[model samples]
Target: MNKVKVLLAEDEASLGMIVKESLESRDFVVFHAENGEKAYEVYQTEKPDILVLDVMMPLKDGFTLAKEIRLENKHIPIIFLTAKSQTSDVLEGFNNGGNDYLKKPFSMEELIVRIKSLLNRIELKPNIENIKIGNYTFNFTKQTLIHSSEIVQLTHREAELLFYLVEKKNEVLDRTFILNKLWGNDDFFNARSMDVFISKLRKKLRNDDTIQIMNVRGFGYKLLC
Candidate 1:
């Protein structure tokens, strides 16, 4: 089996070293970069399987690096490590192409778990095929929603949320259940993030009048077709 390659960029020397060692111990082939520029350089040359980036760096912060990387690869998972815990900060990370965010002073175990979860999410399942939702054709593998002549690209999280809704179409999916299943938590922050993704999904699926993602009062959401 090929070892998973990780490109980790963190300016804090001690923290970077600790993370590098911990991941390496778990058999991950990690390439550590102390600055964002070096991280980008390594990314282009090494083509790591995943990216773990720190928000504050000497040059080209994590968000900027993520944007540049996204231009080249739309599906590579990015995990941002930042000290900032504001809602806006978390949303910015997602907008800038992050698949997951971990605040600073995080435990190594939690980091490892998140990395595994992301890898699991992106791993291809041979059985998954395109699904028809109302008039839109959803290609799970490509993370795209296609209508007559329109194609809407979906982010990783959006695609997952859509998949879950489609799988349980017309059934009430509890908010806590969805949050715990997708995000591994039912915390306030994750709940808010889920809401944002839900709203985005509603907009994407709005062209078809027959398809609606209805919010059940004080319960959760349901995809009614």
Candidate 2:
């Protein structure tokens, strides 16, 4: 079996070494960089399977590096490591094409689990047909939404959320259920992140008047088409 390659971009020297050693002990090939600029350089050469980037780094921040990487590769899983817990920061990470987020002071075991989860998600390829939503056609596999020759590229989380909404169209999807299903926890931060994605999907589908993602007070969301 080929060892999974992980690009870890963290400015803090001690933390970087600890994370590198921890992942290596678990059989992962970790390419550790102390700054985002060097991380980007390593990324281009090594073509890592996944990226673990710290939000605060010299030369290039994690979000900036992620945006640059997204221009070249849309499907590679990227996870942000940040100390900030604000909703806006979470939203920003997703906007920059991150597939997941892990707050700082996270357990090594938790980080490992998240990495494996994302990698496993990438490996699973289900033959799902294109789904229609009002004036748009959603290609889950392609991570795109198309309408009248306009194609809107979706991040991995956006695609997943939209697919779930499509699956439960015309019915209320409990907020707790969605949080658990996608984020693995229904905590405050994850809940805020879910809301951010919801807002984004609403904007993406705004072209069609017939499509609505209505929030059910005290419940979840319902996709009306």
Candidate 3:
């Protein structure tokens, strides 16, 4: 499985590092941003699986940044880290679609549990849609890919690769995870085979201008539209 990347956005340098280190110890890859503007940049570039934000920050506020992130990724979890603790404020956090909110001075253990709980909830959400890629439609349940009146069959491995790629669409997928999950090892031969499969899928998807599979050298591939 891919490690979850979290963005820790807080203006306080010391607190930001503390939260970031704490999450890092839990096996989460964290990006720390001191201000709201910088935080939003990380949100765009890092595309973290979870966002831990402070309510007060320079340039942009937590509520505003959360609102913008909601527009892009409705499913990504957002958690506010703030000292402010009023009924109305908590209500406002939910109003902006936060999955969880952690009050400042929170224990590391509490944060970890909250993060795990939210991630569990995210995983439980149904994954049923037959994804649409330009003229092609991927029937996930059927494990079939169809394009412009023609249907293409996939071996089990190919199907799984497609599933992973689609699941991380618009985000970088680590090569190591894909190799371990599908090939059972991150050997050079397996990597070559994976590349071949990616090429084949690209050919099949050539008609779709809305989707592209890009290699993010040294990191992995990013499927984007």
Candidate 4:
């Protein structure tokens, strides 16, 4: 079996080496980068299964790197390592697309535990297929929504949002719950992003009059069919 791959970016050479060796010992394939710029380059090239990023680094920063990654792949888990333990800093990490945040001096064991938990959660997500939503067929694997012979290709985030809504059709989804599950945070930035995706999905599904995604004021949304 192939080991889980990690892209680790840390400017501190000694600490980076230690982390690389520790994860390697646990049968993880680690790609270590000494700066944020190199980390992004390696990420595009290697396409690691997960990312471990230090907050402060040369070239680019962890938050910036994470934001860029999220734009391309919303599902990839990102763990941010920061020396700052302030609540504001933690919030910043989440707002910038971190799945989890670990303050400096974190235990290696704890990091491994978090990684395993994230992977398990992702793996256990329901792999829905060929779901019928009103007049359209949603193919989750292909990320496509088909109506008769016309097909609309959806971005990964759009497909994920639509999938969750369809799974809970007719139920009012809590905004915070959906935000946390989908964007890894319920921060303002992510909330806006979710709203955008919701609007786009609504427009796409407009052709099907029987299907509706209703907004529950001050709450969340409900997909009615």
Candidate 5:
């Protein structure tokens, strides 16, 4: 079996070395870079399975580097390592196409756990057992969401949101919680983007009379059946 390839970009040499050693001990082939530019260079050459990036870096910021990666492959999982803890900072990471994020001064164990969780989700295989959602039949394992005879191919984000909503059917998803978990932060712009996605999802399921997606004012969204 091939070891999981991880690309680490951190200007802090000592911290980067420690993280690389830890991951390598766990059977991950580690590629290290001291700056964002070198990180991208390594990425282009290695095409690592996941990326660990520092927010502030030399040559180019992590955010800019991540945007470049997103343009090449949107689904590639990215975990931001940042010293900044503001809500806006976290939201910006997600808005640019990050999956899992970690605050700096984090434990190596925690990082490993998060990385494993992200990979599990990225490689998620659903058990399609006739899940009924109003008038639709969802076959998640097949990656096909069906409404009557029409099939909609969902992007990973769309599928993830739908899965979470369906799991909490008839319940309201709290705005802050949803944003933090799904989007990494609850900023004004991300909140707006979430609304847009909600609208798109509602439109996708509009054919079902029994299904409804309601925005709870000042709170979050409720998916009802």
Candidate 6:
């Protein structure tokens, strides 16, 4: 079996070494970079399976790097490491295409778990045929939504959430269930992230006025078509 590839970008020398060695011990192929610029260079060359990035770095910040990467590859999972724990900071990470976030002073175990969880979430499955949603054609395998001549590419998490909504259709998909299923946790950060994705999906599907992703008070969401 091929080993999982991880691109770890951290400016702290000791901490970077520890993370690289620890992931390596778990049979992962880790490519370490000391700054954001180097990390982007390594990312282009190595094509890592996932990226663990530090928020504050020299040359370029983690959020900037993630945005740059997202322009090219929307499906790759990105996890951000930062000392800031404010709600705005967390939301900023997600806005920049980060799939997960870890506050500073975290355990190696928690880091590993988050990495594994994100990897698991992005595992590929057999391609399925496209499904219709109002005026849109949703291609699960392609992770895209088509409307007339326009095509909107979706990230892995967005695609997963849309698929789940399509499966349930008009029913209210519980918030807790959606969180656990997609993020592997219903924590505050993940919950807020879920809301972000939901808002994004709403915008993508706005072309068809008849198709709506309704927010159910205290319940969850309902996709009405």
TM-score of 3: 0.56
lDDT of 6 by residue, 110-225 (tens): 89998888887667444654799999999977779999999998765687789889989999999999887666589887778788889999999999999999999898999999
Best by lDDT: 2
TM-score of each candidate? 0.89, 0.89, 0.56, 0.62, 0.68, 0.85
Ranking by TM-score: 2, 1, 6, 5, 4, 3
Candidate 6 lDDT for residue 123: 72
How badly does each model clash, as a count of residue pairs?
0, 0, 0, 0, 0, 0
lDDT of 5 by residue, 29-121 (tens): 999999999999999999899999998999988999998987787667789999987756765776566775787789999899877777776
Query: 1-225, model 4: which lDDT tens digit per residue?
Result: 878999999999999999999999999999999999999999999999999999999899999999899778767888999998665676567657676777789899978987876777678666667899999999876678999999997765577678889878999988998887765568886677678778889999989999989999899999999
- The segments of candidate 2 whose C-alpha lies over 4 angstroms from its true place after superposition are 126-130, 171-174, 216-219
Report the backbone clash tally of model 1: 0
Winner on lDDT (2 vs 4): 2
Per-residue alpha-carbon lDDT of model 1 for 1-225, expressed as tens digits? 999999999999999999999999999999999999999999999999999999999988999999899888877889999999988888788878788888888999999998888888777433355699999999876778999999998876787788889888999988888887677678988988889989999999999999999999888899998
- Against the hidden true structure, what lDDT does model 1 obtain? 0.89
lDDT accuracy of residue 176 in candidate 6: 93
What stretches of model 1 exceed 4 Å from their correct place? 124-130, 217-219
Tell how far residue 26 is off in model 6, in angstroms: 1.7
lDDT of 1 at 166: 88
* Residue 208, candidate 1: alpha-carbon lDDT: 97
RMSD of each: 2.2, 2.1, 16.0, 5.8, 5.6, 2.5
The residue ranges of model 3 lying beyond 4 angstroms of the native Cα positions read: 127-225
Q: Give the poorly placed runs of model 4, Cα more than 4 Å off.
A: 1-3, 9-29, 33-48, 51-118
Q: Candidate 2, 159: how far from true, in Å? A: 2.3
Residue pairs with clashing backbones, model 5? none
